[model samples]
Target: MDQCITEVKPIKGFYKLSMKQRMGFGAGDLAQNLIYQTVSMYLLIFYTNVYGISAASAGIMFLIVRIVDVIWDPVVGAFVDKNSPRMGKYRSYLLLGGIPLTGFAILCFWNGFSGSLTYAYITYIGLSMLYTLVNVPYGALNASLTRDTDEVTKLTSTRMFMANIGGLAVGYGVPLVVKYFSPDGKINSKDSAEAWFVTMLIYALVGLVLLFFCFSQTKERVIMDEKDTENVKVSDLWQEFKHNRPLRILAFFFITAFSMMAIGNSAGSYYMIYNVNAPDMLPYFMALGSIPAFIFMPLIPAIKRAIGKKQMFYVFLGIAILGMIMLYVISTNEALKGNTWLVLSAQFIKSTGVIVATGYMWALVPEVISYGEYKTGKRISGIVNALTGIFYKAGMALGGIVPGLVLAYVAFDKDNVATQSDMAEKGILWLVAVIPAILLLLAMYVISKYELDDATIDKINREIESRVNY
Candidate 1:
């Protein structure tokens, strides 16, 4: 073991990152979320209401695509680990995969093949698969950068902050842009296909630019040696999962946290358009979902220092539940529903908790990776990230499935734009509030099972580095 460890060298300045590198590293996530958040939040609505697809069909398609991800993620993970492309091991995909990702993303919103499930299947599946190619590598890139727990924490905060900027842009900007281009000046109108296409095209182009920037700015300093790379296998993904307890805990947490966020996000449009009876307020409400990240995310390092990690999760998760309860109460009450201030206030409160809880989870990824390396004596960031990706995508699948199923079950009439049935409105409300609240509760429980605290992970990282140095 000592002889094996002696072959590798400790990375110099592993914990230090310049602000430019941090910001540039973050831009990749920002770019991804700009396109992905739009799909997560609006694609279902677009499919059922505007693009002329059945809710049930779209729901099944979502599940199928994510199931595909379960298989594809491991393949991508193993492939990425084995190959070191000329551009960079992980960064190459940022451009290679990103270009196609942008094109498919734009095509997903186009209505040229109106009401065609084949068109939806072709474009949506393409977008999802290409996304994996980029995402798995991007996730691995985080652990590749450094092993310092504090640096990873700070890096994660910046990444989440930038990611939410994309979320904010998608949440608020998409609607506003689509509305501006719409002939009727309304996003919900069936005739707004042209508007959706144009908006997505611009967003996709911008996302490609940011991805290129991310590729240029980031470097991978702490990575597996070529010999270690040669040993990586797809089956190692499961092998690591079996032995890595923290990864399991974190993976489950991903499922629950992402499910909560996804369900709430998917339900936002219906909540604003139907429950609040204020389409104009949708942008504000959606934008507020991400805006809290700007204020709270930067304070994460301090917040963790003060409260400790688990307590932070407990506090924020509780706040999220409270906000959801408030939203449910206000929306159900006819008089209170019309008051946009109250609704927006509830949104801000809910988002603060959701954003902070979920945002901080990314920081835990490196800890788990370090833990895995400490135990297994192998650093396979790709496989570990692939496992997390599977679970998060599983969570996202629920986000897609639940809303579509609820809309179908409630018998939502796409034709009735003026007002949905009472049952449908209640279902949308449940999706926005009650469902997410339950998921938040589950998330809190799952996070509690995560055993690695900063002190523990810091020790593990040092031990791992010592081995490499000796």
Candidate 2:
């Protein structure tokens, strides 16, 4: 491992990365979203309808996995910060963990152990833990790339763009692929177990190839000293969270933002299938969630320059809320309920806001890391990401918990393929629209508390670099 750690002189001026480097960095995220987004969006539905688990049971499992993450995330973070593999400081895990992550991800969708909670627990938990091993390091790798705020912003934009591409693939592609492979040519049918398993296997392998591409392309430029790494500990994660105000604000914002996305994503298939009575249109509806990112993410740096970060959040989040309202209104009206175009239009509007707002928040992660380093003279990127990961997973837990519980509460009948009860449809609507909108409202408030503007973050980054150079 030591032989693989390349020693480079300390960087002084702005480290402008090549387009290839930026794209390479972004590919890691794209890979992750390819596999993880499928899990986030479709896993619950799989567990319930296809895997024969009760919604309530799946919901409880989701919560338990998050609790495990609460413990596991910090461990991975601290270990990664404290140890540098030969491949790279943080980038090494793209392979080390990525391999197992791919395997577990594939195993997760396997119905070989049909209706077995233990199989679900083992595969899901393994996948989650391995994801942390890869994700925490990948996040730290971002901060380790360069200190230039503008460069980070550009990098983030590219990353989000690629991530949305992955989302698009999963959103539209998964159902298409699954349905194509389904014995009866219906994706949502209970008999499509083999299709789900095969689809996940293909997706997971593709993800592994992408991860390897990311690993081959990325190189860590800025990193902590070996001596400093020795000081890293799991407890330092909590300590940093306690003192880092910007991190705290960002962490809380992560909770709300991810919760909004998770709830909406998890409910999307149900929304189209049950609420809108358009099972065939489910792919288009879900794909719209990623379409806006491509259209708007390229303009992020300019958008931030025009309106400022806080105002950007306010405007986009408001747009998202409006779209959610539109969705709810149209879905409930007898006249508009079955209008596919109107529904797609609403999804487009809502996703446009969501893509920009949540997409841009990632740029802030590096900013907060710089702020922490400025204040404490330590850049524990791994630990910081872990803290944020915990909160975001907390949000994801809600995504799992809320939908399953709501479905169970509404007595959603998985056995009834023809139509859901009115109560079940309403619950699905709440998951897709009302609940997520409320979470977005809270996200708006939480982001309002973030204090690290670009100028402030730049100053902090410069100061930290000067200290490193001295």
Candidate 3:
């Protein structure tokens, strides 16, 4: 069975990773997600409520930043592939880009220039750019570590496990910790500015420490040669997008998948605080997003073996859609809306589907990169990551815009603390339920086109190994 993997003999290019080695690689994602998940889950609310801006304005800033990411991600990718630092190829950025990433991440939550769109633009853009610096290279790092497909599945599982730990920390912990520091113990309010800043500061520091540990533990073995590295170009990203069919399919999947995630996550605080009218339950609701990861992630190998990857995705994605439908039905009825267990149960199911489906997608990245190498004789991991990054941000762009537009259309009032109008509540529900469900459906169709089966990918990896050891 594929799930029950044992250590294999070291092939020319393929090799097994130890537990510490797996954890060390996984730590990079965990470190990044501390800031990434926090920003995704909270920054929009922070902008509207704590930073004293309209939801529409915050949404505009998110759109602009992601647009900038489209250009910036490729540059970082090309740059990384073009040069190798003495520190390491991909691992060097864990420190180089990470320190600045932490500073900007903390700054993004600061309210010193509250309601100043200029200040918001500067800090938020800075944070997004630096995030790309770390993210693009770290993606390359995953493929650079080993060529063993089973090892990558295990590595991705560990990475997602730790990534969800950061998600849990940010999801529940950000609010709970902010509440501890918050004036009147309220998280999303104009007066909670200081609390948001302090909470981010703590998370960012911990992230930096983990990046250091990752830098120490990760080594780059599977990479392009020094000669090949010199020729990597931004245009190569476009070339790969055109020529690599698997990359194209995965790229589109990224857009749809991330859009669904962003929309739901962005709308969650409002759903709980406004729709459910349970501000106290915000942390618990958000924590459900990551709790499923712990329960399900360890079982991934077996799950993949049992049903195969595509079927696993179909099953989970459907479960998520079912969860959303349940949320819509329950929340619409006055009697059922008051049922806390029902609301949380629906959230848990929805989160389980989303977490498992999206988390495992990382394993495909290395496969595509290997495919690219087999076809072109050059492994441009950064360029492929940048292409995926673009689509991922494209999804994020939709994620950023849709919520703001929906809220604006429904006339959501940041000032109205007690409750929103009927239409506004429905808008939040659409964000949490209806819209994301539709996108999940689209993601399902997009992923259905993926042609790489496990056997095909393994044969390709072996062929590449036989030709070039690197």
Candidate 4:
């Protein structure tokens, strides 16, 4: 292997990016978006409706899976950075981890398992572990692609755009597809569970194809020095976490962002079915949650340039908060009744804010990656990703746990295929309206503290390269 040359050049206003790099990096996100959306949006409903698992049990599984992520993420991160794999450090996992992920995901939806608690545990836990292996490496791959701030921004935008494309497909298509498999209009325990089986098989196969595309399209460049293959230690993990300020900021942001999205996404089915009295319309409304990403994600880099990242955060997060408020008010009001349009409108507004804000946040990881290298002459992309991966999973865990607990506490009865009680209705509303709104507000505060803008990051990159070459 040839020694890679490293340097930094400054840019003004928007970061410049070539279309190939942008599209290449974006492909990975599309795959991840599908994988994540399947879990976030559809998995819970599958567990309750098809698998015959109680909501509370499913919620516990969600939490357990996250706990498993905490243990697994660092290991994957450390292992990737240390071993120089033949297919490239991160890209190999797309196929390696993805194969099992696809298989497990399909199995999770399989109705032939006789619906045991133990079977659910095995499939869900294995799938979650495989997802972590793929996800942590993919995250590190982003930072490994380039050091140019502007290129990173473009990469982030393009990646997020592709990701939302996957999101839209899952959000919009899954419900309709699930309905297609159902002999009856509604999915319930009595519906032979074949609908979920068929649905999972479709998503898992589609997801596998997308992952292959990601593997084919992307390549890693400007990664860590080959000589830096020192064994990644437990102490090094603590050191990185202790020293990296920007890493801390991104980590906290992930927690809040994932939690907000998770709670809302997880609770969506219940909200539509119970409160809105339109079980059939859940996909359309849930699709609204991701639809804005298609419209707003392409505009993110432009939006960041026009408003500055911090101000953009303030504006978009505020928009999301406002949308949450509107949802709370509308869901609470009897005059609105069961108007699907009003609910859809609220979902659109809320998603518009969330889609752009959260989608663009991935761009910040590379900046922090550069910052970590600048501060400590060691560019451990895997460890940086691992650190942040902890927070992302943490947020997702909270999202899953909170809703699972809430529904369980309210005594949510999945067997009642027609109508739910007032308590269950309140629980669903809280997940959709109150809980997510609070998390978004907290996200705003955490993101406010994110200090690295374009100038500082550019300066840090130059300073680090200079220090290394000198």
Q: Who wins the lDDT comparison?
A: 3
Winner on TM-score (2 vs 4): 2
lDDT of 3: 0.92
Quote each prediction's TM-score. Answer: 0.97, 0.97, 0.97, 0.94
For residues 1-470, could you state the per-residue lDDT of candidate 4 as single tens digits? Answer: 89989877543222345687677667767776776787898778777866777888888888888898888888888888888789888889989999899888878778777558888889888988888888888988887766677778778878888888888888888778777878885655558478877777777777778778778867776576667756665456678888998889889999999999999988887788888998878888888888887788778778888989999998998899888888888888899868889888988999999988898888898888888788778888888888788899899999988888898999888878778898889888999989898988899999989999999998887776565521
lDDT of each: 0.91, 0.91, 0.92, 0.82
Model 1 regions more than 4 Å off: 1-13
Q: Which stretches of candidate 2 lie over 4 Å from their true place?
A: 1-13
Model 2 global lDDT (CA atoms, 0 to 1): 0.91
Expressed as tens digits, the lDDT of each residue in 128-166 for candidate 1 is 999999999999999988887778889999999999999
Clashes of each: 0, 1, 0, 1
> 1 or 3: which has the higher lDDT?
3
Give the winner by TM-score. 3
**Candidate 3 lDDT tens digits, 1-470:** 46987876688768788999889888889999999888888888888888888888888888999999999999999999999999998989899999999999999999999889999999989999999989999999999988888999999999999999999988889889999998878887788899989999999999999999999989899987889779788999988888999999999999999999999998999999999999888899999999999999999999998999999999999999999999999999977986778999999999999999999999999999999999999899989988899999999989998898899999999987769999999999999999999999999998999989889999999989888845
The window of 10 residues in a row where model 4 has the poorest summed lDDT is 9-18
As for lDDT, the candidate ahead, 2 or 4, is: 2
Give the worst 10-residue stretch by lDDT in candidate 1. Answer: 4-13
Q: Write the per-residue lDDT of candidate 2 for residues 433-462, one digit (tens) a residue.
A: 999999999999999888888888877777
